[model samples]
Target chain A: MYEGVVQDLIDELGRLPGIGPKSAQRIAFHLLAADSTDVRRLAAVLVEVKDKVRFCRTCGNVAEGEQCRICSDTRRDLSKICVVEEPKDVVAIEKTREFRGRYHVLGGAISPIEGIGPDDLRVRELMTRLADGEVTELILATDPNLEGEATATYLARLVKPMGLRVTRLASGLPVGGDLEYADEVTLGRAFEGRRLLDV
Target chain B: MSLYRDEGVVLRTQKLGEADRIITLLTRANGRVRAVAKGVRRTKSKFGARLEPFTHADLQIYAGRSLDVVQQVETIASHGDAIAGDYGRYTAGTAMLETAERLTAEEKEPAVQQFLLLVGGLRTLAEGSHPPGLVLDSFLLRSLAVGGYAASFDDCARCGRVGPHPFFSVPAGGVVCASCRSAGAVTPAPETLGLLAALLTGDWAVADASDARHRREASGLTSAYLQWHLERGLRSLRLVERT
Candidate 1:
């Protein structure tokens, strides 16, 4: 371990999700060598973000106040709600510009191995959002992994009685990728979900 | 760096970096192997989907200093989609994968039996021929047997006395004779014990014909036996839909 505060900094950075010990040490040293003004700015922003940001009341997406930008925007279609595993997924879908509807961030998928289930996520909040019967369609854009699929299944079953048109995102070949190179599962899914060409 | 080829089932994966994952597989020849699959999270990755859990694949790996590197992956059977498509199968398959990983324990130590069991279990699960719970119980019991914790259903686990034991004990291994019965031994239905034996011996006709109540009882005993031997219960086991 290094001296007092420097070692503390490294330890704290190492606590982050993806930052390892080596990267933590490297980042700590880089911060020590960096300009004091830059360090202070970063520290201030960190504090400010924690103080200012909160989860949206309706959809559970990260927000500055009561609701996230999407939830608060009246222009977004209220008849549809896209369910995603995380807040970052909201940004990804927003980037696509194809989905004009609102979103419901589930925070995380149902991972039994990780001791996570439907109760651990914002599933209740999503159900409550659909309780008013305004939502005609619910798009499950959860990742195509085991946990994500489980989450989708759980949600679909829960909302089955409500009679909403629940749909899951398609899993298949990536755009601009070769068909032969595609994995059999993906190719099979593509075939299963095949669409006819427009005239 | 030496390159070796092996057929294996992907047991699980963990994120290593920005675009890489550490995949753990039970290979036919090399036992349990953990390898880094770099950039597999990228959209354009050559074989990202091929390395998912429940996929049996032929892999070309480059031995690295710490963890091996996956060079190329060819899909032998993609059971992931089939298993993941249903909730019951997904949870059951997850438990099977976890059990296989736990049984193998040591890396690159040629656990061919466990590997084959996993592949077969996955294939059967994907095909949806048998109930997911039955497949998982069979897989777990067989895996325990391969790991040297084979539970004796017919004879006493301790005294080796023959025929129709009354008490079932997890720590004592399986059904115990009246004289050999210890404290906390459960007296399960005779039918439950029969179902377990059928599951262990690959008597699918009997297993398929077993009653639901007996199946649940047998599953409970199987889980207890597995957990007692494994020391810790599998996380995904509780999530499996028995009904």
Candidate 2:
């Protein structure tokens, strides 16, 4: 059996996805042998993330103060809200550099088995934001899964009644995949939501 | 010893250190199961292809303290290929996988109803007979029912008073009367409740007759009901295309 603190590290690491007992032990040892300064910095950031960053009051995205950077940016289009499930998704969308609109992060998607309901998320906050009538088009950017679709549909129903246009992300099979490799369900969605190529 | 056989659908698979694979399955008799399928990464392995996601199979696994070892596998239905061929079903199936994993976390918990329902749902999806969205909604409603969170459409979800209830409360459970309705729950159209009941009971004749608006409304109800019970949101549900 492993020692107390080392075994504790292994136990904690094992709880993470894709990490098994062996990997957890390996990682624990590696971390134990790592430089003190490097380990201290990693530990410091973990604490800072919770202490410094907080959910935005207006849109629910992660923020340093009252509002997130995207929400406070005057250049961003406030009238169009791109709704998403997690704050991490805000980073993903910003990476594309395509959208310059405000965001509404739902914090989590609707998952019933875990007992996660619409009330558990910041959905009521979204309705409160829409009440101001500044948002016109609400882009649903949740994951391409059942829970995500459920959240998007729930959001659409809530927003459409308020007269905002709700649109979901178009479906397409991932790139670099062979036609033969593509599942018919995914291929069918690509056909149904087909786009006109500029080229 | 005799083969300890059980029915399951492969939830996911990942390559292990080298030639092995870690397969996650939601079994009928056993809840969620993880087993090592040795040398499955190699092309010559006999049952390697049997562990693909969405494929329903009967497995005989060697019980181990550290990790169960897959002894043999027999394909019950090769749904993965057919389901993967369509976009809507694929995305919907992914959500089903997450739901299945959440519903049955403990090993050998006798999730027979859930396993059977998923099998039927995947079979229906692969055949491309009913609308993919409707099929998924039915699966979601039934899955919740199997988990003991069945939503009432006709009777009051709170008082058991029978009548045409107008309000759908995810937190309050299901359909609610004017007396039982919370201050802020969204009231879906009457036709939406009918579609939901039909979907829950597998009365496709009623569900198939639903118009686009009714179907959409019913879907919203089902998804919300599901999320209310499943604490962590499904990672795949965001991809569902609304009609």
Candidate 3:
């Protein structure tokens, strides 16, 4: 523990995810040594973000208003909704510029060890969105990991009776990754999902 | 500081910084150890994908003051991919990992039996040889046994009386005879007790031939017993979709 406010600052910073005690202390000292204007700017942005941003009512994506930009965009296909685990994943998919459709952010995956279950996520909201039968295709863009796959499987089973064409993202080796260095499971998946090359 | 090599299972991981991760591993010889794997969050990380949960890896670690650093890691079994593809297996595997972590509460203590049980459970789960739920239950029972909390299915837990016990009591260690039966003791079907015994003893043929209803009953009893012994319920066990 340090003197008064310095310890308080470290404790506060440490509460943030991924910021451990050592890093929190280091950051607090760095902030104290740096210009007050920079620290104030960062503080202001943090408050501003919490005050202005909210989850989109329809899709659960982070938004400034009732709906996110993707949810509000009429040009995007409403008949398709690419479901992702987080808003950050939405940005990653959007950067590809390939998916011209709406999105449903599940907030987080079903991590039982973390005590996050189907009920904790935005699953009910997603089910409500699909109840209208407007979405013709539901693309599961969840990360290809344990929790992500669990969430996808749960959602897939839930929406199977709804007659929606559900699909999942193809997972394989990275573009520049070497085949010899690839793990057997990933290599096997790459082979299983091999595509025909077009010249 | 010295460097050492060990084969271990990746029990869990937490993000340490922008591009680093702190991994908790249950090693075959070293027991539970937490190590910082620098740059594992980066896209180009050499062994990042191999260090995921349920993965068995051969790791070279650099001993540090507060935490050991993972210098090199090579994949031994990538069970994560197989487990993740199926919901039943995924939940079961998650529960197994959690149990392994919980059983080996002390760090750097050799827990070869617990380690072997986890590896075997993960392998069986990945192979789809048995119902994922059964494998998970078996793992839990065996891990508890190795952790010195073995529950008795046959005979009495408290009085050690002979003959098949009729009542199961969580607080009394396991199945209790009428003479030793305490409050809140449950009378599971004879088949549920048989199923639990089969799972604990690795009698897969009997376990596989068991009915679904018995399996469900056995699962409930097993979970209750586990919670009672551990003094807390496993979060992952609640999410397991029994097959």
Cα lDDT, model 3, residue B187: 92
Decreasing TM-score order of the candidates: 1, 3, 2
The TM-score values for the models, in the order shown, are 0.95, 0.57, 0.92
Candidate topping DockQ: 1
- On the 0 to 100 scale, the lDDT of residue B101 in model 3 is 91
Name the better of 2 and 3 by TM-score.
3
Model 1: residues with Cα > 4 Å off, grouped in runs? none
Worst 10 residues of 1 chain B by lDDT: B78-87
Least well predicted 10-residue stretch by lDDT in candidate 2 chain A: A177-186
Candidate 1 per-residue lDDT, tens place, B1-243, comes to 399999989988888879899999999999999999998888678788889888899999999999999999999998876777788888888899989988888899999889888889999999999999999999999999999999999999998999689799999999999999999999999989999999999999999999999999999999989999989888888878777
Fill in the DockQ of model 3.
0.56
Per-model TM-score (chain A alone): 0.96, 0.88, 0.92
Docking class of 1: medium
> Candidate 2 residues B1-243, lDDT tens each?
334678789986756866788888888777778899997755345566677778889899988777788998878887765665455666677678778878887776778888888888888988988998999899999999999998888888889888788887888888888899997678888888889999999998998899999988888778878887997667666666555
Q: What share of the true interface contacts does candidate 2 keep?
A: 0.00
Model 3 TM-score is 0.92
Lowest summed lDDT window (length 10), candidate 3 chain B: B40-49
Residue B138, candidate 1: how far off, in angstroms? 1.1
